[model samples]
Target: MDNLKFENILGWKVPEGSLPCWVISESERLFSIKEKKPFYDYSPCCYFKITQRLDNNFIEGHLGHSEYKGKRFHDDISTSYEYFSNYQKREPVYFSFDRVSLYRLIEIIPNKPLSFILKRVDSPKAIKPNRAFMIMPFKIENLDNFYQSYIKNYLKTEFNIDIYRADDFNDNDIIIETIYNQIEQSEFIIVETSHPNKNVFFEFGYAVAKDKEIITIQNTEIEKNLFFDRAHIRAIFYSFDNIDPFQKQLEHY
Candidate 1:
């Protein structure tokens, strides 16, 4: 992207026959830029509600209008609305954000003009959710499954907010940095208090200091050990066999 030059991002587009084009609004555009800070100038009630990130120079997430003019994205990113939007297909697609123009404000429309500047990369085993972060131990039985299948699905479906845990990403070279990044990106957090982990507490403490909306989840069987009481937030206790109580309690948040 450094080599390619474009003054304005809106004028950009995915390349011809590229994985697909995802014309991002001003909000998604802010994420692609380095210096500017306003998320989006205009959006239709954040209806599309999707997220994307540039990792290893590749773009990942529900690339097509997760900012949905539709339900899901297909290979022809230009189309594929009104279907199950599954960017979480166990494997993630990686693409690149490109620019064809030299100036932000200037448009050089050729005889055959095109704007999309995204390139597809065949990367695998990576899924990212930017809205919420989960801080729980990986060692817990079926806990990861509960998060991925039940919790992640519910939040994305009900609230359009995607949740991710540290283990969700295949890469953890700089584990602490990644954890901090997720915390910073998240609008809220769902942390576990059952069978508490020290590192989890440390991260939770950092989030508290940052003034993030924190929600705790714990198994009913485990006693709350050295409970953290900050901002008067309490943990939502649920049973693995019955998640009904947790679902009902989450609305209070």
Candidate 2:
């Protein structure tokens, strides 16, 4: 339970382009981002691919690569739960991903020059299914009908998960604190991107940089809504009141 507040900085000119994760100031909670370069790494990654933490200061890529080429499990916990195994790299100009892809991960470590053309392969999914957090627009109509009556119950029943929704709380003082706690504790996150909600997207970006399991739900594809929305992430597109198919697509999890 590392309840430490994340570090944030202002006036940072992140290398221009499609960059998402490592470029983020050391921690995922950093709020101010300055766009400097014209590059974004939407490269694809799968299991057994090279990887590393994005915030590593070293200019190399050899810290958290696949070890023993095997998965780890715990005796007390169920193996059904997936984990985002630690994959921090540094050397030869280290880089990282937001790890926000729906079904796959995009791991592209560049050379000292920061050119991400070295290895563009698919990386396996990293997840911890024990806990999940939900983020959505706060001012939506019929809030109870849209969430409590439908989404919440449906998810709890289908996935048998322990979920934490932000709006469920009434303490404004603790909302941000709880949010940080919930996001850190939750193994996966259910983001409602149905609307161009900056709060929701900001939280989504936080989850991406933290390397948490992300499950995004959107009414439609609004490319303009998300500044870091160029990558291919598995999104469940559904109309309000229709959730049958949403359950089906979640099987990919």
Candidate 3:
């Protein structure tokens, strides 16, 4: 088993032998088997050993860490092989591994059924943009301050991107035309669908029709009130007390 040659699996090299093996590395952290790439970002300060490879397309492993937060902690890491296999069958699987404070994507051989890639799925690049046009119920009291202080400021400080609302424009053009023009000029759209506002829905539909990047944010209290037609769409839920997580989510795009 020691003499067996290994191949790249995401950021790790896996041996060809069938027996369970422990991969020990001093500097190497994250590896991609398909791309044969290595990423050092948020590399776990630990070692991993493949424990079992099940016939049901699942692989189990143990993560043994020497030190974490000035203490030792280890746990079992189990994942299904079918997840990566099915994903690779269609397109390359690019994903990240969350390490508490930081994360990174390590691609793996999509054809290898036993391979595991973990983390949040990467967002599509088509909707990523440097500027976002925000559509919300601006008439609502205190909503303007929330946008300016929480949403707009956060985007500017963290992502250095400009976010504009309808009030940002000073042109004397018709309201609908002005909005459409703003949508045309912006790279992406951020829709606040927390409330049942028809204007926001119309703007969202227009943005979708234009094939623009779209991100939806809503207050958690309004989840049950989400329109039936838009219920299936994913949205970032937030509350006044917990807006940081949503801001962090937006930074990814």
For each of the candidates, the C-alpha root-mean-square deviation to the true structure, in angstroms, is 15.0, 17.6, 19.9
Q: What's the lDDT of the predicted structure labeled candidate 1?
A: 0.50
What TM-score, over all chains together, does every model reach? Answer: 0.48, 0.44, 0.46
Give candidate 3's TM-score.
Answer: 0.46
Return the number of clashes found in candidate 2. Answer: 34
Q: Among all windows of ten consecutive residues in candidate 3, which has the lowest summed lDDT?
A: 95-104
Q: What is the lDDT of residue 184 in candidate 1?
A: 65
lDDT of 2 by residue, 99-177 (tens): 3211112333343322122232222232335668888877667644666755677667876776778866434212454
TM-score of 2: 0.44
- What is residue 246's positional error in candidate 2, in angstroms? 1.5
The model with the greater lDDT, 1 or 2, is: 1
Worst 10 residues of 1 by lDDT: 99-108
lDDT of 3 at 211: 77
RMSD of 3: 19.9
- Cα displacement (angstroms), candidate 3, residue 218, comes to 0.9
Q: For each candidate, what is the lDDT?
A: 0.50, 0.45, 0.53
Residue 243's C-alpha lDDT in candidate 3?
75
Model 1 residue runs over 4 Å out of place are: 1-130, 224-231
